[model samples]
Target: MSILTQSAAFIARSCARLLAQDCLLCAADSRSSLLCTACADDLPRLPADYCPRCALPTPAGEVCGRCLRQAPHYDAA
Candidate 1:
Protein backbone atom coordinates (compact mmCIF):
# COMPACT_ATOMS: atom_id res chain seq x y z
CA MET A 1 0.00 0.00 0.00
CA SER A 2 1.03 3.65 -0.55
CA ILE A 3 2.49 5.71 2.31
CA LEU A 4 -0.15 8.43 1.78
CA THR A 5 -3.01 5.91 2.06
CA GLN A 6 -1.54 4.44 5.24
CA SER A 7 -1.05 7.89 6.78
CA ALA A 8 -4.62 8.95 5.88
CA ALA A 9 -6.07 5.77 7.35
CA PHE A 10 -4.11 6.26 10.58
CA ILE A 11 -5.31 9.86 10.85
CA ALA A 12 -8.90 8.81 10.23
CA ARG A 13 -8.72 6.12 12.89
CA SER A 14 -7.25 8.59 15.38
CA CYS A 15 -10.01 11.10 14.63
CA ALA A 16 -12.69 8.47 15.05
CA ARG A 17 -11.26 7.47 18.42
CA LEU A 18 -11.05 11.06 19.61
CA LEU A 19 -14.55 12.03 18.42
CA ALA A 20 -17.69 10.76 20.14
CA GLN A 21 -21.08 11.14 18.45
CA ASP A 22 -24.53 11.14 19.99
CA CYS A 23 -27.40 8.93 18.96
CA LEU A 24 -30.25 10.78 17.25
CA LEU A 25 -33.00 9.01 19.24
CA CYS A 26 -31.62 8.74 22.79
CA ALA A 27 -28.75 11.21 22.60
CA ALA A 28 -26.28 8.68 23.95
CA ASP A 29 -22.65 8.54 22.87
CA SER A 30 -22.45 6.45 19.66
CA ARG A 31 -18.81 7.10 18.62
CA SER A 32 -18.53 7.92 14.91
CA SER A 33 -22.09 6.80 13.96
CA LEU A 34 -25.36 8.67 14.53
CA LEU A 35 -27.09 5.79 16.30
CA CYS A 36 -25.90 3.64 19.17
CA THR A 37 -26.00 -0.14 18.91
CA ALA A 38 -29.01 -0.54 21.20
CA CYS A 39 -31.01 2.31 19.61
CA ALA A 40 -30.17 1.01 16.15
CA ASP A 41 -31.36 -2.44 17.08
CA ASP A 42 -34.59 -1.04 18.59
CA LEU A 43 -35.52 0.78 15.37
CA PRO A 44 -38.40 -0.61 13.33
CA ARG A 45 -37.65 -2.72 10.29
CA LEU A 46 -39.55 -2.55 7.00
CA PRO A 47 -42.31 -5.08 6.54
CA ALA A 48 -41.96 -8.01 4.16
CA ASP A 49 -44.99 -6.93 2.12
CA TYR A 50 -43.68 -3.62 0.82
CA CYS A 51 -43.65 -2.34 -2.75
CA PRO A 52 -40.35 -3.16 -4.45
CA ARG A 53 -40.45 0.06 -6.46
CA CYS A 54 -41.42 2.71 -3.90
CA ALA A 55 -41.00 0.87 -0.57
CA LEU A 56 -44.63 1.55 0.39
CA PRO A 57 -46.54 -1.12 2.30
CA THR A 58 -48.63 -3.39 0.09
CA PRO A 59 -51.12 -6.08 0.94
CA ALA A 60 -49.70 -8.76 -1.34
CA GLY A 61 -46.17 -7.41 -1.87
CA GLU A 62 -47.13 -6.20 -5.33
CA VAL A 63 -46.50 -2.77 -6.82
CA CYS A 64 -48.40 0.07 -5.14
CA GLY A 65 -51.25 1.93 -6.92
CA ARG A 66 -49.31 5.18 -7.14
CA CYS A 67 -46.38 3.49 -8.80
CA LEU A 68 -48.76 1.75 -11.20
CA ARG A 69 -50.35 5.04 -12.28
CA GLN A 70 -47.11 7.06 -12.44
CA ALA A 71 -44.06 4.84 -12.51
CA PRO A 72 -40.82 6.05 -10.92
CA HIS A 73 -37.54 6.18 -12.81
CA TYR A 74 -35.72 3.89 -10.40
CA ASP A 75 -36.41 0.16 -10.39
CA ALA A 76 -36.35 -0.23 -6.60
CA ALA A 77 -36.43 1.96 -3.59
Candidate 2:
Protein backbone atom coordinates (compact mmCIF):
# COMPACT_ATOMS: atom_id res chain seq x y z
CA MET A 1 0.00 0.00 0.00
CA SER A 2 0.97 3.66 -0.29
CA ILE A 3 2.93 5.22 2.56
CA LEU A 4 0.29 7.94 3.18
CA THR A 5 -2.50 5.33 3.38
CA GLN A 6 -0.46 3.23 5.83
CA SER A 7 0.25 6.23 8.02
CA ALA A 8 -3.40 7.23 8.14
CA ALA A 9 -4.44 3.69 9.05
CA PHE A 10 -1.90 3.57 11.85
CA ILE A 11 -3.12 6.87 13.29
CA ALA A 12 -6.74 5.68 13.25
CA ARG A 13 -5.85 2.47 15.03
CA SER A 14 -3.97 4.33 17.73
CA CYS A 15 -6.94 6.61 18.40
CA ALA A 16 -9.40 3.78 18.83
CA ARG A 17 -7.18 1.93 21.33
CA LEU A 18 -6.91 5.09 23.40
CA LEU A 19 -10.68 5.39 23.83
CA ALA A 20 -12.15 1.92 24.21
CA GLN A 21 -15.48 1.86 26.04
CA ASP A 22 -18.18 -0.79 26.37
CA CYS A 23 -21.07 1.60 25.72
CA LEU A 24 -19.14 3.15 22.90
CA LEU A 25 -19.33 1.09 19.72
CA CYS A 26 -15.93 1.67 18.19
CA ALA A 27 -13.30 -0.30 16.34
CA ALA A 28 -9.58 0.07 15.80
CA ASP A 29 -10.44 3.06 13.68
CA SER A 30 -14.11 4.03 13.38
CA ARG A 31 -17.57 2.75 14.31
CA SER A 32 -17.52 -1.06 14.36
CA SER A 33 -20.75 -1.22 12.40
CA LEU A 34 -23.81 0.77 11.47
CA LEU A 35 -25.31 1.00 14.97
CA CYS A 36 -23.73 0.37 18.36
CA THR A 37 -25.29 -1.92 20.95
CA ALA A 38 -26.40 0.91 23.25
CA CYS A 39 -27.84 2.86 20.36
CA ALA A 40 -29.34 -0.16 18.61
CA ASP A 41 -31.09 -1.42 21.73
CA ASP A 42 -31.95 1.91 23.32
CA LEU A 43 -32.89 3.84 20.20
CA PRO A 44 -36.12 3.02 18.41
CA ARG A 45 -35.63 1.55 14.98
CA LEU A 46 -38.15 2.50 12.33
CA PRO A 47 -40.36 -0.48 11.62
CA ALA A 48 -40.81 -2.04 8.20
CA ASP A 49 -44.38 -0.83 8.06
CA TYR A 50 -44.41 2.93 7.73
CA CYS A 51 -46.13 5.67 5.80
CA PRO A 52 -44.32 6.05 2.50
CA ARG A 53 -44.96 9.75 2.20
CA CYS A 54 -44.77 10.90 5.81
CA ALA A 55 -42.12 8.38 6.87
CA LEU A 56 -44.13 7.57 9.97
CA PRO A 57 -44.93 4.17 11.41
CA THR A 58 -48.03 2.35 10.22
CA PRO A 59 -49.48 -1.02 11.06
CA ALA A 60 -51.10 -2.17 7.80
CA GLY A 61 -48.49 -0.77 5.41
CA GLU A 62 -50.85 1.95 4.29
CA VAL A 63 -50.77 5.69 4.63
CA CYS A 64 -52.84 7.16 7.41
CA GLY A 65 -55.97 9.13 6.52
CA ARG A 66 -54.31 12.41 7.48
CA CYS A 67 -51.32 11.71 5.27
CA LEU A 68 -53.51 10.58 2.40
CA ARG A 69 -55.37 13.87 2.46
CA GLN A 70 -52.66 16.37 3.35
CA ALA A 71 -49.78 14.23 2.06
CA PRO A 72 -46.34 14.26 3.59
CA HIS A 73 -43.63 15.61 1.33
CA TYR A 74 -40.73 13.70 2.96
CA ASP A 75 -40.66 10.52 0.91
CA ALA A 76 -37.31 10.11 -0.84
CA ALA A 77 -35.23 7.79 -2.94
Instruction: Give the per-residue lDDT of model 1 (tens digit) for 19-72.
Output: 768899999989888999999999899999999999999999999999999999
Q: What's the true lDDT of residue 32 in model 1?
A: 84
Best by TM-score: 1
lDDT of 2 by residue, 1-77 (tens): 99999999998888777754444444323344455655667776678988767767889768867787876666631
Candidate 2 local lDDT, residue 14? 88
- Scored by lDDT, model 1 comes in at 0.94
Name the lDDT value of residue 43 in candidate 2: 75
Candidate lDDT (C-alpha), each: 0.94, 0.67
TM-score of each: 0.59, 0.48
